[model samples]
Target: MDTFRKFALNIAVFISFFSGLNAQQTYFEGVYSEKKIIINNPLSADLFGTCIHRITINGEIYPFNISDNYLEVDLSLLSIRKGELFSMTIDHESGCVPIIYNKNDFKFKEGVKFISLKADGNKLSWQSQSEVLLSSLLLELKFRDKWVKIAEISSNGMGNQNYEYIVPFLLSGKNQFRISKSNTKQYYYFPVIDMTEQHYKIASNSVTKHINIIKNNKPAVTCYELKDLHGVIVKKGIDGTIDVSNLKNGFYKLYFDTKEEVIIKK
Candidate 1:
């Protein structure tokens, strides 16, 4: 049974009174997944064939069928994507607000847990307690002020599972790491990890021949990348000196170790 990547379907019912005769609203919010979820009588209580005035899903009215005072909710009829915000409001008699019977199914499954995420050397490792079958987990690292997917791992879906991925190199300063199932918004964010060791300096912001990096007031060899204003990497390597003479005269981003600088070729 290949289940979904652990998403939540929330159920909330708040009744408002309007002289005890007006329609009340019930709301449901959650993150959607691909797993086929067909919950019969999700409200647990049978609704009167005509008591339900209207039902809306994601701000749109939802069509439903009622037979023998029973309302069936089949979400598969809609084109909902994973991590998409799902909200539903039902307008009905204030005396009869539908209650969710399967609210437990709208939360993380039993034993599915996010233990810890850590980075060691050039590798990142994390663990989780999982259900029987789950999708692969994504590894995202904050790079250049953006979250970039560096690696991914197929989860074991076992009890107390461990996973690891080797990174090419660390960002060289304060950076963040996280893991997620499918949605980028839904993730386990780790604490900031500072890899900055000694202070580094650029010899010149406007270069004519070469760019020299100084660490602790001395020439330092480090991994560096040079990108144009359009974010195109023009040059990258590991050296204490970068020959920018070949680069066109323009503004360029310099990523030296953990520090970033802007340089002009003049």
Candidate 2:
């Protein structure tokens, strides 16, 4: 089938699916929250680019640019109520795409919850009260036009999900850290301190997961943590060796105190 025909068929099928859904169920109520609309069998970025020209939610149309895999939209102005049938149509230059998603696909949470945050010299720590797994907490600095993530720490499981991170070099004045659950929109951010003096040395072999850490006169913590790019904890230790023998070949960070070393596992 031609590209236009395939797109038309998809939209038709999508609309038909939603038309049959129970009219009592409404997905996008007029609640003010950031929600992600994940597309099924998503089109290639190369083909559609990042922005969608227009989005028809119910009968209202809005324009938005998708920055990543899913389209992020605000559900504040949408008149649709919960327990009612909800449908959206996205118009692109190539084709008009329609999608019907259940509540399971759209991820959203209402307001922000406060986390206990503190800074002690080059270290930062925070705690969560809920017994829910959260995404890795990321140390980030504003760079150019975007916030560049410097390091990640896992926040999985429940109870007092506390974490401590040492600050590396502050690349920019605007620095903040954030933590989130894997798929939910609930994220917590903490402001970071930009330090001028180096308190410790964090070095490691570029090819292996072994890291060498040394603290000067500062009272540094003995334990260390390992996290992937997404802030997921791979491993942690309090002993001498920071091992990554089981981890696959990828870039990782070994964090301790206010120091972090990048490790490229081979």
Candidate 3:
């Protein structure tokens, strides 16, 4: 007919403009200062560092350390990262907490060190070039309430396009904290009730440690064991004491030994 209906309407408008540019939805804008945090990823050379950035207050997790001028992030925690978009300022000399990122679609994959996230059933498996294939990749899933955001994936085979976001936390019985990239600035204190008596007394923010208590799901107690002067293992059931005082401050997770402590209840 008329040239095959204009070649099927020009291949359906070029496959709907290449599926709307692969579903697009990756834009981040920033500008925060106290020392630095100015991000304007007009796709900044297509995601400068390659992506592995992080920021989460109420739930912990705060990892971002790109350098060159600045990009520290974590001003004292306030809950950030809703697809990125900020503008802050306050650098007085060495207050340090800058943050800036417009990093286009994000990408960063060099030698590929580690990227892992697990949870299989509803789906969530993203492993990097190697971590033993991270159990085999299942990809995509984000719910975040009790927590659930597994392997957001992105690697392109290492050239300079690495993006790995793995999140999973639904251990209701509690105990799964994570936050320690460390420059200095820590606060984690939880004790309302549940130590069954072993002696009590806590408050030494020298970056205290050791405080994991999960009840039912497992792991009952352990309290006190701080470390992070570069000693690495930041905190792990510092001494062993949980009475919760009464319970009602909010946020908790202290698994001790194996590692995993993030507490707060004031």
Candidate 4:
């Protein structure tokens, strides 16, 4: 009788522990093959009856209803290319919105392509091949002097994969150019003057060219070739100007004769 009682107590303890675990946020990692979709509640507690939920894609929000164990989210709503990063959020019992899943680990296949950024006056237009309805789409804009962000608008999926996005205003100065994207973390510094005309030109010459060393007026310790490094070697008295027009956009460390300078080739 004592052994039977002990067994019952052990089972009770196990059940209690299991229930506690289910009440917390869980991280799930998996891949969807053959277009198979799996929908699971992110909340620790069981969702009973009808629950209202929102689906955000690229920055647009769509409302949906959760009834059974599976929430059938239409893949067509995603308009995802072969290997694009897709994410969704869920409302929890604590009233905190949490990211349920993101395709950060997925890679695009051959036929998948994303809409490139188009420059428009002070705004950017992003068009996709499929219509995406989302709760929010974060926009990150880069300027010559500083970076600014603006939440423009939201809309429902009209079964078309095109979207027109516009930035609020220019950052501040005259030489400032803006590049924008949906992801706030990613930064693009390319110079875009107009989007309506799709005219994007490199801002190489626009960058201030000056030599900055550890000691501005000190003697050189070592001599290295500037061309050897990843920068265009614009000789002091060469043709028209330092033909860095071909250099890819980014920060490059340039060494002139014995003086080393950092050049931002945007």
Tens-digit lDDT track of model 3 for 136-198: 222321112222222323334421223333332222233333211122223111111121322
Best by lDDT: 1
- Once superposed on the true structure, which residue ranges of model 2 sit more than 4 Å away at CA? 1-114, 172-174, 197-266
* C-alpha lDDT of all candidate models, in order: 0.63, 0.51, 0.32, 0.38
TM-score of 3: 0.16
Q: Write the per-residue lDDT of candidate 1 for residues 2-116, one digit (tens) a residue.
A: 1211111111121122113465666775544444333233332233344455556775445544221455554545666543446666666555556555554444342345778
Worst 10 residues of 4 by lDDT: 196-205
Tell me, by TM-score, which candidate is best. 1
TM-scores, all candidates, are: 0.38, 0.29, 0.16, 0.26
Give candidate 1 misplaced runs (Cα > 4 Å): 1-112, 132-134, 198-249, 261-266
Off by over 4 Å in 3: 1-119, 126-169, 173-210, 220-266
Task: Write down the lDDT that model 4 would get.
Answer: 0.38
Error of 1 at 203 (Å): 13
| Pairs of residues at least 3 apart in sequence or in different chains that clash in candidate 2 | 24-83, 25-83, 25-84, 26-83, 26-84, 135-180, 166-257, 166-258, 167-258
Which prediction has more favorable TM-score, 1 or 4? 1
Would you list the rank order by lDDT, best first? 1, 2, 4, 3
Give model 4's clash tally.
17
